[model samples]
Structures are given as structure tokens and as C-alpha cells.
Target: MKRLIVLLQVFLIGACLNKELTNDQELQKPIIQSPWVENPDEIGHDFYPRPQMKRANWENLNGFWDYAILPKGEKLPTLFDGQIRVPFAVESDLSGVLRKVGENQELWYRRSLSLNSLQDGKRFLLHFGGVDWESEVFVNGKSIGVHRGGYDPFSFDITPFIISDEDQELCIRVWDPSDQGPQPRGKQVNIPNSIWYTPVTGIWQTVWLEEVPEFYISSLKNTPDFDKKTIEVLAIISSESVADKVVVKALDEGMLVAETAVTPGEKAELKIQNPKQWSPKDPFLYDIEISLMQGDQELDKVYSYAALRKISQEVDENGIQRMMLNGEFLFQYGPLDQGWWPDGLYTAPNEEAMLFDILKTKEMGFNMIRKHVKVEPAQWYYHCDRLGMLVWQDMPNGDHGNVWEHRLGIVGKATDKQRSQESEQIYLNEWKAIIDANYNFPSIVVWVPFNEAWGQFNTKEVTEWTIDYDKTRLVNSASGGNFIMDGSKITGHMIDLHSYPEAVMPDPNIFGKDNILVLGEFGGLGLPIAGHTWQNEDNWGYQSFTDKEDLANRYKQLIDKLEELIQKGLSAAVYTQTTDVEIEVNGLMTYDRKVIKLDRDWLRSLHQKLYDLEIQINQ
Candidate 1:
């Protein structure tokens, strides 16, 4: 405890943390919030932000918070400008303060905490789901700590700051440079233009508080061994402090399937009689309860869930490499899901609205989603895990200098940028944090480090390092970006290419011999409906259609081509996008999500063929 307090005092940090055209200036166009936001407090974001490891005794600190914008290096302000909604960025309409905090400015937030009937002998922790760029925290005017990453969650033990159960003031100071710096601000820019979006500043995710005993389970790392019919869990204790032992129990519908116990840092293995493997067709999940115990006394208990699945690569009889999920060749097809909201920017107005996109994707008969170049809140991935969506999670790319804008597929130039030491370190730190944060999710099958050469550096080294770091998931070094070929083989696991308007695959004869061939991005068929679009003017897609019928017909033609590519060893393909973002109208659905441009039955029927298309090989 003394060491923890000492380290918290000197917390000075300097760490940090993609598509399409058209820009709408000063979007003053009578933007209506999603019906989901109509009763923002009624139903939203109350779900456990970290679903994998959930405790019963935790406070949800996601309501109105007093905020002020101050100059950089300025002292804490005694008076705030106004109230801004917590867990929403100030630049977002949902935040109630549509403003931008640039590099020269700092965003300050304050809220009072009145702790009553506090649990005895328990430590209090204040957690922020996520804050943009850099953030500093203060409790009752005493500086606690600071964090720099914009996407990953962080917390501080505020038990020491709680003044005898009185009203305690909690404040946070945040500064984000957005695209102005080398941080990983994916698709965010100060000046909005073709493919860049309005800046998101300050806290954009839920803020909460949790209490625990002195020695409790902080995190659980669960790994399911599909072949061995067992699950291994390692419970990490708070502050690396030791508990006597931790017990892991696996249950199926409240029936205990297996149970085991081991020391806190040691792996506890539970052998199952018969494991029901998780797949897109049947995403069976086993309920997990992790408990920390000292002798006969249980100190902490956290509820979690895990799925038994395996991802591997196999060479077909035709000598084409394929992605094997659970030892089966399942051709993956989904959209380039850019998880953005017109009103919420990087966030959705509510939880149901957030799940709507994923639910619609499943309804549209898609089995996978390439989460394009941006990290979402944990709940978003939790939905995918439960709904059985295979995910290709991209590490949000940034520090752009060698951005391959025009050099597209087949005849495109593959370029690698030389980043400064600080920039490279920033990328590495944030990339690791993102992976570690989302590592436990069973839905994510692939980790994409770079997309389309945006801030791509040391491809071979980074790709190899990611592979070494997490051997469970496949690494796409530079998705649809530079295919840095080492002799004949590319640096990444998949040979990915980007082509607009039509689906295309890498030549199986050339690169498919070793790498899994995939169409990383294609099909930007746009049919913007009036009143549902972000802006009435300048809304564009790669190919614009006047009517839904024409769009469907064109999409059918693309699917026909994809069927041919599937036979030519294409293992997976990602459509241009799930919905229109800002003025770029290339989406299956409009930006507002009120109108789904494609007919559900028609699109699903057309998509089912791609999934059923068997790779015919000369026997």
C-alpha cells in the first residue's frame, strides 16, 4: 500500500494513443439525436464496461459532469464553464457541449462523490472507461495520477482520497492534439475533409467506481484449450499482491461443468468432460466465476464467460492457404464496420443503438466484421462475442506521413514510412495496450496493426512481434496497405488488397501459395436517402446509385465476382462499410441508421451464396 501511494504521486506520463471521402462543414443541418438518446439517462451505458470481469459491488459514475475548457499549463479552475455529459466527448452532440479542445487548450471535468455507508476494510477505485489523448486526475485538489492513452481503460485507487465519507471532489484534465500530433487518432482531424471526421475530445466512455478487499482479483486471463477439452485461468491480483489461492469454475446454464483452484499467479486448469466448441454457427459460451480465497474465506468474486475456439491456418488440397476456424474452412465475409455515430462521433448515443449495427450485420447474413482502424468500448465486442461475429480488430493507425492514398491494389506502390523514436514508441505502447485490453474477447480472430499504409513502419518487425505476443490470433501486418514482400512471401499472415466498386482477390498463383488471400476492402455502393444523410449535398460513394434496386443489382454483380474469387482461393472479404459516415455515402445503411439502403431479405439471400460457395479444387 505504501509503495502504491509513492508511485501514484510521481505519475508523470507522456504516452499516447480511416476511410472515405467527403466533408460537411459545420454540420448545422438540424441533426436529430437517435431515439436512443431521447432518454439518455433512462437506458444506456449502465452495463458493466468490462463485461469479461464483472463484480457486483460497483458504482456507475456516468451522469452529468461539470466541465471547463482552459488554456494549456493553466492551474485548476475554481469555476467551470458549464455541464457536459460524462462518457461522451465534448465535440459530440450527445455531450451537451459541442466543442473542440485543441492542443493549446485543456478540458477539465469535476464531480463530487459523497461516500456513505462505505464497505468496511474495502479499497475504492475510480475507473475511466477511456479518455482521449492525455489525462490527469485530482481528488479533493490533490493530484493523483495521469494517463496518456485515448482508448484503453485506466483507474486509480481513490480510497486514500476519500475524506471520512464526506463529499469528495473528483477532477480530470485532458489534452488531445487529434491529428495534429503523432498519437493514434484514427479518422479524426482538426480540419474535416474527405475521409477525416470531427475531433473527439475528453472522456468518451463510461466512468465508474468499484470496491474490493485488500487482496482481490484485478483481472483474469482465461484460455480455452479446444483440443485438450480444458480451460486454463490465471487470476491476477491487485498490485501483484498474493492471495492464498484462486478458484475458477466453469458452468453451463447454472450447472457446474468443471472447477479447479491454484495460487493467484499460477494457472488453474479445469478439465471438461466434453467441450462445445465456439463457432459462428453456434457461439456456445461457458459461464465463469473466478473467486479469490484465503484459506476458507473468499476474498473476491468476479463473474466472466469464455468460449472454446481455435484459429489456425491450413493448406488446401489445391495448395492454397486458407483460414481454418475450428479446423474447418469457413470463408469469412463481412463489412468494413466503422463504429461511428453521426451525433456521438466515436461513441453511440446508447447501448441498444451500439448493438443495432452488429445486430443488423448478423441479420444481413454476415458472419464476420473487420472493425476498421478504430477501437470500440468493451461492450461493443461483448455483443459480437455473444452474437457470434468473427472480428478482425484493427489497431487504430496514426502519425501519417507515408499514407498510401491513391496507390491502390494490383498496380499500387507499397511504401513504408520512417517514424521518429517518439512516434514509434507511441505506436508500440498504444498497440500493446489495445491488444491487452481486448485480448480476452473470443470474437476477435485477427489483429490488424496497420491499415492502408497509414503510419506503417517496420512491417516485418511489428508483424512478427504481434505474432509472438499473441499466438492465438492471426496478425494482418498492413491490411490493404503495403504488402512488404520478403522474397516471395508477404510480411503478414494474409495477402490483402483494396479495390473500390468491385471485389477482387490476390492472385492465388502468385501469393496464395503461402499467405491466405483476402479482399480487405471493396464495394462502396452508395444510395443516400434524403433526410437520413449527414448532409444533403456532396454525399458520395465510390459508385452512386439513384435507386435501391440499382444498388442491389450492382451488389449482386459484385457477389457474382466474389463467388468466382472464392473458387480462386479467396478466404475472406470485407465490404467497404456498414453505414455512411459524415458525407461519404458509401454504406449499406445511411449514417443515421434510420434507413438501411439494401433490402434485408434480398441482401441476405445474395450473401448466403458467398458463404455456401465451396472452394472447388481439381481432385
Candidate 2:
């Protein structure tokens, strides 16, 4: 009996210690989470990152990765702290290791991937959809290469680094200074605040591997000429030997609508008879197939897509410069989408979560969305294209060395920040790459280069360059940015102004003839619902309200003012935001995407007024 009692005591002590350890582990976990935060799949972000350019066989390398955070100068740790979910930043809750990687620390990730037998002369490429600031990749302990620029997709040829058919080790080292550096990191910051939120370090997007032929098509540039009823495609091929020809095909619902053949590197014009125009009402997309052929044999084949659309600036019946879509003067209205998530900082929890925002924007009767300050995944744009939503994409801002003087009502000249040669080069390179990368999306109608003068520089020159680069789309060089003026002319396609709590527009009487007048940003109405906020203490908005009823009333009043401005000459308007982010509670939906602040039916009814006016005017 004494021995049995002693054994029971020991068992009880061990149980208590185990319980304490479990509690401590729970405490270390992330508190805030999204609705989709379940056990991660074997391959996270398994969906094809590039829908525009897709191949049949590719491996998703995005499940669990051994991670370690060490001092900036420290070598790679032999042992890892724990397993973290790939494609999620260290600071994000869904990463499984919600720890801050400070500016002084380097984040490392290690994993192993097994490969199947590959065809002879084929090359294997490791692709990263995006990584925060800087990344160095290694395969089988062999250094592959490094890539910078957080918002762009990059790939490296890993054929030479793959040493064995067995599991090969993959390692990545990342360093991100966030706001400390001069990189264009959007709204990421170390400390959370009213507007700025968490910093995303290391890989925050899909990592995959693709096997392709030695000679392959590198990229496709599709441009639709609405008047000519022809789609022009430029297939860029990378090959050591000259390819015989390139074949392009456009299909509608599986039937071939148009097909053409041209020289490998030249442009192929595929003529479509009675091409269905892509618009917010009827978003029609034609599936495309491109093949690189050597005489009678096909070397490589890729699947792509395109839409027939056009955007331009023209004088309407009211003698005002109006933004025209598909040769018609249509008013665009939507929310200013920041594209941040509570669970996933830069990435959405899943494709559904990403599509939810766009779907909700449409459900709320908004025809457009101004992607504010940040870029989203390629699939996000794909959703927009298919769902028939207009997009105005902003170039992520960086290098804030100049003071911005708001000249909302007054005629403001461009505030030129004399950026260093290096800073200017970085900005220019990234901006150009972003444009080139996203050029194929049909939903993007406008390219906003600067926002409210955040890192504004060389306004006139940049505006001209953008116009020259892609004449297919209109350029709002500075959306609510410092208006660059030449006497009476504000240089750019649009003249925009931002007002808080209520809607306002650029003075039509002053600059109505030359530029399209728009309310780039306005009506940041805030109502923080308890239990749905990022934090209870410091949650805020431009105009705070206690209840949903009061918030809706205030929003209705703002729309009434906006309707009055529409008659005065406003062509488009972007409401403050789509969802609450961090402490700023001005979103139509909560940060966790749990609640819609206002009644959707009522909001939609109110928004229909703007489109009704456009229809009446056109009639």
C-alpha cells in the first residue's frame, strides 16, 4: 500500500508539470485568428500562383518549414526552433510561429522536397511568388541565387543544384528592415498603430517548382484593340536555337474562336469577329493557348487568357473630361481596398478569403476597387477579371523623405522630393516591373503611381513615362497626390482630391476641361463593433459612430453629398476602405471579416444612385 501511494504521487506530479507546459505553449501562440485558421493542409497555397501563365506539372513546396530567427550576422542555425507554415510571414498568426523578426535579426527557413523522374534536356525552375525584402535560396546545400523586391515574383533555375533523386534539402535566408529601409513596403511597420500595421518578414507567398523544356516561352503580352476587333499577342521566347514558328489560339467556352501563327518573337494578331467586350456588366474572357514549334514538332506549350476592353479619357455631353470604358462614359465607384488580413498580413488566408472582399465589393453595388498602396497576388487580380470588377492599382509607396502639404481645395503644384540616385532607381525599377507584370489583367483600368504625395518625386517625368509605357490604359499619375501643374493644366489623365468623413471632388470649374475630376478618397466612417476589432483600446476611424444604424445614416449623408458632386463633374470616387485593418476601424467589414458593418441591401440601394445618374445622362 505504501509503494502504490508513492507511485501515484509521482504520476500526479508528472501530470501537473505536463499541464503547465501545455498552458505555457498555448500562451505563446497567436491570439488573433481568422475564420479559416484551421490545421494547415499538407501543401499550403497549393493553388497555382500564376493563372495567366500555367503549365501542367508543377510541385507546391509550401507546407511545413523548419524556421529559426537569429541575429543579423549569425550563421544559419543547425537546429530550428519549430515548424512554421510556409507562404505566411513570421509575424502573421497563421504562420504557426507568430514571433516578430526584428530589423536586427535574420529569418531562415529549411525544408526538403522529393522529385520524380525528369525528362532529358528539361530544366527545373524554383519559383517564389513573393518574399518580403531580401532572400537567398539554396538547394541541396548549393547556393542558388538571391532576389530583392518584395512585391514581384522571381524564379531561379535549380536544375544544376538538384543533386539526387532522393529528398533534396532547400534553405532560404531572409532579411527585411521593413520601414527602417528605403524599400517600398507599403503600410508595414514594426509597431502597430492607427494606420500602419504588422511587418511581414521572409516568404509570404507561394513557393513552387516547375519543369519546362530547354526552349520555352518566357512571357505573353496581350493587347486588345476594340475598334479593330483583333487581339495582339507578343510571345517572348527564351531559346538558344531559333524556333521555327509560334502558334496562338483563342477559345471561347472550349470552341476555337480565333487562331494565328507568326514568327517566334513577333506579334501575332488573332482576329475575332464580333468580339464580346469585357465590362463590369459582361466580363467575358477568352482562354488562350500558345505553342513554340520547331518545324512539325512542338517544343513547349502554355495556357493563358485575355479579355477585350479599352479605357480612355474623353469629353462628355456636359463638356467635362470623363473616364470612358469600352467607348462609353461610365462612372466608377468602389472602396479603397488596402488588401490586409488579420490572420495573413500580406496574403489572404485562402483564395476564398481573397475573393470574399471582391465579391462583397460587388455585392455592395460598387463597380470598382482602388487597390490602395499595396499589390495583391496574381490570383486576386484573376478573381477581379472573372467577376467583372474594375480596378485602379496603386504603386506601393516608399522613401518618405519629403514633407507633404495638403492642398485639397487650392491648386497645388507638385512637391518634388529630391530623392537620391539609388532611391529613384529602385522606385523606377519596381514600378516598371509591377506594371509589366500586371499588364495582362483586364480589370485594371487605371495605374495610380503616387498616393497623397507619399514618396512623390519626378511627377511630370513619371507621368509621361507611364503614358508612354502603356497607352492602353489611362494613368492617374498622382491619385490625391501633389498635382503637377503647367500654368492651368494639371499633368495626368485625372485631377483628384481627398476629403475625410464626407465625399469631395477636385474643383471642376478650375480644371474640368483638361482632366477627369475624381474623389480619389473620402468618407472614412468608423464603427468598431465589439469582438471584431484588432484591439479594443485604440480602435478608431475618420468619423466614429456607436451603432450600425448611425453609421449607415452618416454614410447615406456622405453619398448624398457625393451624388451632388457627380452632377458637378465627378467621374469616379473611392470610399475610404473595404475592411478594417489593425486599429483603423473605417472598413465596411471588420478586420477579421466576421461582420459587415452596414446593412448590405441598404448600402447597395444607396450606391445604385450614382450609376442611375450615369444611365439617365447617357439616355
Candidate 3:
């Protein structure tokens, strides 16, 4: 038996080496590669996707998978076109197959898994962090299940379908109509241009398998209350038999600060003495551990973390409404971050590449980012929580039939789009799932439901529901887009307006007393570097500039105007973007992230002027 085990180990090592060589030779070279793309081991996103609920036993199913693109409604083909990298969209250069799977086609993926990794009497869960549009799963040619939403995570229990002695065959079918369908696809279009980008089809995130007990912890919701100095935790457990009890622990730098035992599915309130508050300047998080118990035996355990903070709006000493962080008024200013990549499309080339953007944003003297019309992997938010950056997350937009009047000078209310019942339900379901999945991240301070007028419908009802569902965060019903008016007054918590080429805010005299005025978007100044642009000819910006000195000077002028608006009760502002996307050259950085379009020190000094005004407000 010892000799047999030695022989098996050798064979497995040889197989992995052979597979690596094949992957390198079979995949297509990317047109433009990031710094981390040279190494084969760093090709896919291999980190643990879910950080809020983490366990010890899991396997990453990223690397290479056999892929074939065939006509729609066709049966699975026995022969594959080639090997494509998992988690990168098929149309992306990193996928090793830069081929478009259009509305009339379907993308297929196949991989083989060994069941020897599974322990006896343990259930195996297959998880897909994200798959675009529609997906169907199959094991050993038997159908498992189907999922429709594109931006949310989905999982399946595949223990029963596995054969104990033989290797398991896993296959997936994905169909994404992109902009042609009513599904929520943000900025993806068939023909990429100006603001629209290349469509991402099939899996674009981490795919993995996890081992769990028959009864295990499914999910967790953490809400922090600074006034009460307590953290509320709600753990959802799955089981056939009722769990005897649940143990929750709060640790500060590895020392136990608070702990409690409660019944399964019950809310547990853990109190701490003089808890550290979380803010952009000092982000302190308390680690948490939860375990499902039966008598004295522990069935399962998961790790998480939370912060103690509060966000609200109130009247200041100057009699102007201001956005407050913790308890004091703060002037929020940041870029409109559209999370996209040149090589990987929807997915970043590597974890380091993803962190570079957030770090650079901070280095540029910004404290927050409005994640414009897109949701990112949980790890992105995790970095924000640890590194201390506030986030205003937007729901992905889709299904547009109404005409969006870009009434730049007009201030009256805009009409909401009339969507069918099916479209409305789809939008609501996905929005709720997104909010629930990301509720624990402390960096997220605002939930933005609509952008401009692109799929806006039933604005009043949706905004009210979002506020009711999660009272901890503020809700921006529409960002610089449409305004659902309650008679003459605008709905939602903030009055947002969009202006191009410069900063502008709503007239404080008309909307100041009731709502916090904000310049949701402005200053899309364009400066396209020769080699860094997506295209040389058609690239454009809201206002075009030539040299770095000119861009810096123009941006400073915009900041000067913004300071004046702040004096007029502008509570927050979001600049055009953090990075240039596609043919739009209005970003602080170029598309490839290789160049900063303007002077960094000069820009930081200019931004300091905005932050200085916040100090004056407090004084």
C-alpha cells in the first residue's frame, strides 16, 4: 500500500506539470497585459472570494477549463474549441479565446474533479461567485440546476451526484444577451464605443468547492450601532435537526472582548466597552467567530469581522443640511469609480492589480468612491474596509425603453420609466440580493438604485423599500439622473445633479433645507495619452485638453468652484472617474493604469482645499 501511494503521488505531480504547459501553449496572448500577467500561477483570481463568512476547508476551481462556443439551443459538444481561463470572460483578452459569444450563441465549460478530496459523510457545495446572465449546471451529464441573475452569487449541493470511486465530470452552459436582453448588465455592449464597453459573457469570478457538515452556517448579517456601543449579529443556519446553540465571539487584536451564546437563527447582541469607531482616517475592525453547536460538540464554525459606526444627515450650526459621519458633519468627495479593466474586462488580472486602483485612489487624497453602476467582488469591499475608504455602491442597470432627457439646465422633476411587471420583479429581486450579500461591509455608506434614467421605474416605491429594508445606510434613489418628485419636492435623502466639464450643485435656496445637496457627477475633463487610449481616433471626453499642465490647472479651477458650492451647502461630490474606460478619456488615470494623466502632488494639494472646508464646517 505504501508503494502504491508513492506511485499515485508521482503521477498526480506529472499530470499537473503537463496541464500547466498545455494551458500556456493553448491560450491566446493578450493584446495588452498587466504587470502580473507574466506568471502562469497568477493568471486567475485564486483568493477566497467570500471573506465575511469563511471556513477552513475549500478548493479553488479556477485555472484552465475546456471551452466551446456553439449556436444557441444546441446540445453540448463532445469536442471543445480550446482551453479558456476560468473567471475571465470569453471576449476578454485574458480568457485565451478572444472570441465574442453573441446573443445567438452559448458558451460551454467542462472540467473533471477527483472525489478523493472529499471526506467521508461530508457534503460538498459548489459555488460560483458570479456568472453572467443565465447559467445551467450539469454533473455526469445529469442536470443539476439553473440560475438567472448575473451579478449575484449562486451555489449548488452536488454531493449526491458524485460517484465515489470515479472522477466527477462537471459542465456548465451560459447565455448572456447583454444589452439585447432585459437583464441587469452594466455598461456592456456588443459594439464597444464612447461610454459603453465590451460585453462579458460566462463566468467572470472565482469558482470553488467547499466541504461542510450536514448542518452548517449559511449566512450572517452584522449591523453596528455606535450610540449603543453594541454589534448586532444574525446568523442563518441550515440543518435537518435543530442546532442546540450558537456561540458568538468578538475579538480585538486576537484578545476576546465580548462573547455570547444564543439559539440558532436568533439575533445576538454583543456589547463592547468603548468600542473603536470606523472612519476613513482610522478604520478599526473587530474580528468575530461563530460556531454551530449541538450539546458540547461543534458542528461548524465561521469567521467574520465588523465595525462600529453610524451615517446620518442633520442640520448644522450654519442652518444647512450636512452629511454626518459618526456624529460630526463631513464633506464627502471622491471619484465616480467604474470598476473595469483593459485585459480582463470585468475581472482584474490579479489581486495585486485590483488593490493598485484602491491604493492609488487613496494616494490621490480621496476618502470615498461612488462605485458607478456596477457591483464588484467582495474582496474589493474588504480592502476598502481594512484600508479605510468609504463606498457608495450602485445597482447594475438594464432594460431601458424610456428616453433620457439630459436636461443640463433644467431643475424640475423627470418622469420615471414605465416597465413591465416582469422587468420590475427582476430588478427588485437582484437589487435585494445585492444589498443582502453586501450588508456586512462597513465601507458601504450609501445604496444607489438608478443611474441617470437608464432603467428607472417605480422610483418612489423602490426608494422607500430600500430605506425600510436597511435603515443603517443612506439611499440615493437616483444619482444625477431622474428625480421622482413628491409634488414640487424631490424624493430620497439627497438632491443630486449632474454637470459636465465642471462642478455644479442644486440651488440651495430651493432644495437646501429639506435635502442634502450634492454634485453626483461633474468634471469629465479629457486628456488621452497617445499609447494608453483604447482607440486613437474616436476617443473623447466631456471637455478636451492637451497637456498635463493644462489638465491640472483646469481641475484646480473646478475644485475652486466646488469649494464655493460647499459654502452654499453642497454636502458631497463625485468627480468624473478614477480611471479611463474604453474610449472615454475623462479619468484621472489612463485605461491601462500605466499613466497618471495629471500631476499627483498638484492634484492632492487641490483636493486638500475641499477637505479643509469640512474643518471649517466643524469649527
Candidate 4:
């Protein structure tokens, strides 16, 4: 992978610990797999990776693959080092190769392909759910394509390189600088310490193959108009000629609600009468089907889904700006979910384990989740979409050279980090790809381009550009720093402030005049369990507690303060986290999700009060 001069922030909160980690300490780590992980030695994730738009004629190639760690300039391995599990990072325990491949080395993976289902007059597409940083693909030793940006999915057409009749071979080479280079690596470091965790290199998501016709549907972009009761779909087609059209259908429980036909490049608007609006209380998704057609023949058909939900803002009767969900004010409260796993650093052990966090968050009376500075797999968003959970997606933070020094409950204006032209373009490209990849998911209500001003530059331009690109959702330009509340330079849809250990917000009289006021992060009440932690000793939180009762009481106090702030026009709030990660022990649950540090019922009761304000949002 290419390298850039991205330096570290001079100051990182929390004193440095674990500076002298040894191989013995790594050996002593217990196997802390999730409860939903079926097998520890053998990983299993057979579910379809891409759920937003799916086709039946696909094969999951996620079992075992030969892997080798070689020098950065070394050629593709002729002699494999060993077998590493596909989709799991090489450093993960489940991969059977808990070894770090640093910037000096590159990770190579190759596996035999099965073409038993190969069909005549069909095209084959090789797909990788995600490969960290950068990756190059090869089919039968013929170079196919190279893909950058690990957080987004990519694929290549292998029909040209496929040796159809005989056996096939698929190979990939991945190089990730992790924290050593300038990339959007969130909470990852070459050496794990404090809040930063171990580096994740190589394929961290699923890999598969798909079969399609020559003129197949490449992608679908859906936009819903709740006011007009209509859903518009643009089915992009990959074809040799431009004589094809597409038919779009919106269905309710297998029955048709609306249907329309338009050219493949044009948007097909389907109008629905009396549409059922989706909300946190009742998330109703309409099934959709798009078919590529000639004059009288249907060539390809794909299935997808969408929701008729609206995200907006309005001035309240008290002359304060409030975030509106479905034309009503609804409190958005949830944990700052860092999508990490004890066993799987970047990838989940399986689909069930991935869904477990979202399920428990809902059960604990959370309506929204601020996915902290990291993007999750599409399946995670799909779960939230189906389960009626709101999401505020973040562009994973990296290239940290700016000043983000907000002490506990302190506030100030920070300087923007100056970035190289390459670094800036990298950020822009990945940000757009991340949005395009997950645009169809109804769960995502807001998009955060920067958090705590990490690598934040040209904020006004970035925010305005994002707003112009996708008007369907709100954008938080900077989540936690450089407050622009005087209405002079209000950049994005919201103005956020960072508070710690206690609930606090900007003055609604000032901030709420131009922007939606929110507590971007607060209430890091921590109670680390005895045996469930990444490290045995020196585990920490913003405010550490020893007992469950004390933590619960402290949390209640914070929630009480939050309720008062909500009354004063705090539009939304995000707690510190959902679970403890690595050595930072500020979570309601332990790292492995085995123990709940606080009473779930009490949390639910406390959270319900925030939602059950005077302005009730209808289901």
C-alpha cells in the first residue's frame, strides 16, 4: 500500500499503560469469544454479505484459505506459510494465526475455487466484502483489479481471466499500514495501549462469487419521499448495449403496492397510497424487485427493500431547533457503539454475534446508536433497519495531527489539521464510497464526517458537499469539537459538544437557534468485571466505579441531568459506549458481553423517561 506522512496527535487522553507488552502476555490472553460464536477453531459465516441488494445465484467462499506473510516487496507466495481462515484478520485468534503483519510485511491469501455450478453464456463476478487498507486480486494467476479503502466493499469481473473448463484458483494480496500510515484507521495502533487496540490486517470481511447475465443489474439507489408517499429507485445496469430498460415494484407482504418501468439509467418513481411510515416503534419495510428487460424479455431480476421514514428538523414552539423524526420530536439516545470484538478485531465472529449487540441495545431501551468513528458491515445496518433502531454513521477517524484537547467537561476551538493533497483525496473518496455503499439502509439518519476534529480540514466545503450529495439524511460536520454555535459559522445540520462523566450540552438559547444541539458523548460510568477484560489489570474508564450499585446510581444522575438538558432543547445524546473495549472499561456490559454491569430494567426505565417527553412521537 502507498504511504503518507500522517503523524499522531501529540496528546492522547489517559496515561500510557502496557508499554512493555511481551509475547508472554499475548500468550496469556484467554479465548474471549462471543456467546454466539459457534466454533472457536473453525469460523463460520455463511450468510449473504450484501443484504441491501441481493441475488440468489451467489456462492459464499468463506471457509479456509492458504495464507503467507512475506516482505513488502516479495512476490506472490509459491510456498504457502499456513492456512488462515478467510474473512478473519490474520491477527485474530479465530483465524488460527494470531500474528501481526506490520507495514514491513504483506498478507497473501489463495484458495481453490469451485466452478461446479458454472453455467453457459454467463458472467462470473468475484467479490470481497472488505480487505483492510489496499488489496489486489488475481484469478488463475491473471491480474484482475486492485481495490483501495478497506471499509467499502469491492468486486471484479473474473469472466475474462477464468479458465472455464479446468480447475480455478483465486488469490489476493493485502497491505495495511494500520496506524503506521495515513488512512482512516479508527482505534488501531501498531502497539496496543490505552484506548487503541491491536492492528487488523488483511481480509477482515467475507469473500464470495456471483453469477450474472451479461446485461445484469449492477446496483440500486432508493430514495423515499414520505410527504409524497412515493419511493424512487434508480437501477444501474452494466451492459454492452443501451437498449435495455428496468421495471421497479414495491410490494407489501408479497402484494404489489406500486410499480413502474423506466430506462435503466433513469429513476423509477413508485407512488404508494396510504404508506405505512417506518419509525423506532414500528419499522415497516416494503419489499422491492427490479428487473432488467428488453422489448419483451426479462434478463435479470433482483430483490431489495426500503422504508418510508423521514428525518428532518424544525423550530419548536419554544423557538428552539429540534431534531424531528416523522414530523415529531423523538429523543435519540443510545451508546457510542465501537463495533469491535474480543476475538474478531475488525470482523465479527459470525452473523449472530454481530446482531447480538444491536438486539441487546434495543432491549435496553435505546432508540439510536452513534456508531463511534467506525463503519460496520452492511448486515449490522440491516439489523438496525429491520429492528427499528436509528443510526448515526461515522467516517472512521484517522490521520490525527489536529488539536482535540477537550478536557473532562472543557470546551474550546481547535485548529484543523493540514493534510497532503493525497490524504485529502483519500478521505473524500472513501467518505463518498462509504455513503454510497450504505445509502439504502433506512436505519442511518445522520452522517458524521469528522469526530473530535481528527484530520478535520476544509470543514465548510466537506459539509456542504456531503449535504448536496445526499439530501436524505442530516450531516454532523464535527461531532465533538470547535463549537460554532454563534450562528456565524454553523456548518452542518447539527452542532455537537463533547462532555465526559456528566451530561452537559450547549446553551439552547444560542446553539439551538441555528443548529440542533446534542451531547455527542457523555456518561462513561464504568464497572469492570473481574475476569472479563482485554487486560487483567490497570483497566480504566473516564470515571471508574467498583460496584454495580455505584455505577447504576452514577448513571441515574447523568440521565437526570440529560432529562433537564432535553427540556432545554438537547436534540440527541450518545452515552460513552455499549460494552467495554480493550483496556478502556466504560461500558454497560463487559468485553465478552457475558456480564451486565448494571440492571437492564433500571436502564430501560431511565431511558424511557428521556423518550416519553411532553412531545410524544407517534409510532
TM-scores, one per candidate = 0.93, 0.93, 0.93, 0.93
* Candidate-wise lDDT, in order: 0.85, 0.85, 0.86, 0.83
lDDT of 3 at 113: 89
Tens-digit lDDT track for model 1 on 1-619?
A: 9988777655422112011111111234226455676674653477888999999888999889999988889998899999988788888887778776777789999999877656676898898888998999999999999998888888899888778848999999999988878989889987666788888889999999898888788777888778788888888888665468888999998999999988878998888887888898899889999988878888889999998998887888789999888878888999999888877888888888999999999999999999987899999999999999999999887899895743433535656799999999989998998888898899999999998889999988999999999988888888888778766688778878889888888878888787998889999988888888777688888999999889888999999999998887999999988999888899888888888888888788888998886754422
Clash counts for all predictions:
1, 0, 0, 0
Report the Cα lDDT for residue 559, model 3.
91
Error of 4 at 132 (Å): 0.5
Candidate 4 lDDT over residue span 7-57, tens digit each: 222232221333233111233334465675655653567888888789998
Question: lDDT winner among the candidates?
Answer: 3
lDDT of 3 at 505: 83
Error of 1 at 198 (Å): 0.8
| Cα lDDT, model 3, residue 282 | 93
lDDT of 2 at 77: 72
Residues 1-619 of candidate 2 have per-residue lDDT tens digits of 9999999999889866743342113213434556776655522566899999999878888878999888787766789989988899887777888777756778999998788765686888898888988899988777789877888888998877776557888999998887777778889766555677778888999999988888988888999898788889999987664678999999999999999999888899989977899999999999999999989899999999999999988876667788888888788999999998888888888887888899999999999999998888899999999999999999998888776665775765446898889888878988888898899999999999998888899989999899999989998978877888855788888988888977888777788888999989998999888888877677899999999888888899998988898888889999989998888999999988889988788889998888888522332
Residue ranges of candidate 1 with Cα displaced over 4 Å: 1-32, 40-43, 117-120, 240-242, 403-415, 616-619
Query: What C-alpha lDDT does candidate 1 achieve relative to the native structure?
Result: 0.85
Worst 10 residues of 2 by lDDT: 19-28
